[model samples]
Target: MSPVPDHGEESYIGSDRLKGRKALITGGDSGIGRAAAIAYAREGADVVISYLPEEQSDADQVLEYIKKSGVKGLEFGRPP
Candidate 1:
């Protein structure tokens, strides 16, 4: 099967609309959830992402991007 396509990786300019906000996102290891986490961070919000343990690698990547936004980033793993 083909890997899921995620267009959220495209560069997005943030306007600080979500500044000082905290976001909790599920299924954030990939796809739309990952994209939202990136967007939220760029918008100046702390981000927490939850996903299946199997998706830890992907979640790590998203967390890196989130941290680059100069906001806090957290990862939660659910039992498979």
Candidate 2:
């Protein structure tokens, strides 16, 4: 891991473009959805992410980041 990956967690410059909005991101436990989940919340939007039960740990981490922005964060887990 010479170069740590970037998930927009530190590079995104959100400015209310998504304020008063809500986003439901699928496969949000990792990958693009994870980035979106973080970005949306930082922009002042409530975020809901959907993931499988096995992915709860990853999803939970994402929620923690989202919650730090002082916005709502929710998760929907479906057993597969």
Candidate 3:
């Protein structure tokens, strides 16, 4: 994969539309969920992501990006 499936790591432009909000996202370890989590954080919201234990690595990446967005991020993992 070319990583062309944008998780908005760079190309997203946030305008604080979600400022002072909180979002809970499932499947946030990858795909659209991951993108949403990143976008939510960039838009100035605290984010919580849910995923399976096996997806922890991917979730961790999302968390990093979320933090870089200057928003708080939380994660929960369940056994698959």
Candidate 4:
């Protein structure tokens, strides 16, 4: 499968080595967290992302990308 274009880079969906694996990302809403989420999704890993309440949009974008990679993308929150 071909990789989808994102942030000027292309993500290959079929080249994922982590297919079926699950990962939890502490800051998966933005910055390094978002990058890691995309990479993991490309590698076929299901992702659980935690982010601040204010970062919902960022987290949603990352989760959307993860879903495009045909993997599960779960997002939660950082308790106050």
**In model 1, which runs have C-alpha deviations exceeding 4 angstroms?**
1-7, 78-80
Better of 2 and 3 by lDDT: 3
> How many clashing pairs does model 3 include?
0
Can you give the TM-score per candidate against the true fold?
A: 0.85, 0.85, 0.91, 0.79
Where in model 2 is the C-alpha error above 4 Å?
A: 1-3, 78-80
Q: Write the per-residue lDDT of candidate 1 for residues 10-68, one digit (tens) a residue.
A: 57768899999999999988878988889898899999999998888888889998888
Report the lDDT tens digits of candidate 3 across residue range 4-44: 68889998978899999999999998999999999999999
Model 1: lDDT to the true structure: 0.86
TM-score leader: 3
- Give one digit per residue, the lDDT tens place, for model 2 in 1-80: 55866777778767877888999999988988999899999899999999989988989889898888889998898564
**TM-score, candidate number 4:** 0.79
Better of 1 and 3 by TM-score: 3
Better of 2 and 4 by lDDT: 2
Q: lDDT of all the models against the reference?
A: 0.86, 0.87, 0.92, 0.80
> Model 4, range 1-80, lDDT digits (tens) per residue?
25642541254344778977999988988777788888888888999999999888878888888888888988888445
lDDT ranking, best first: 3, 2, 1, 4
In the predicted model 2, the residue pairs found to clash are none
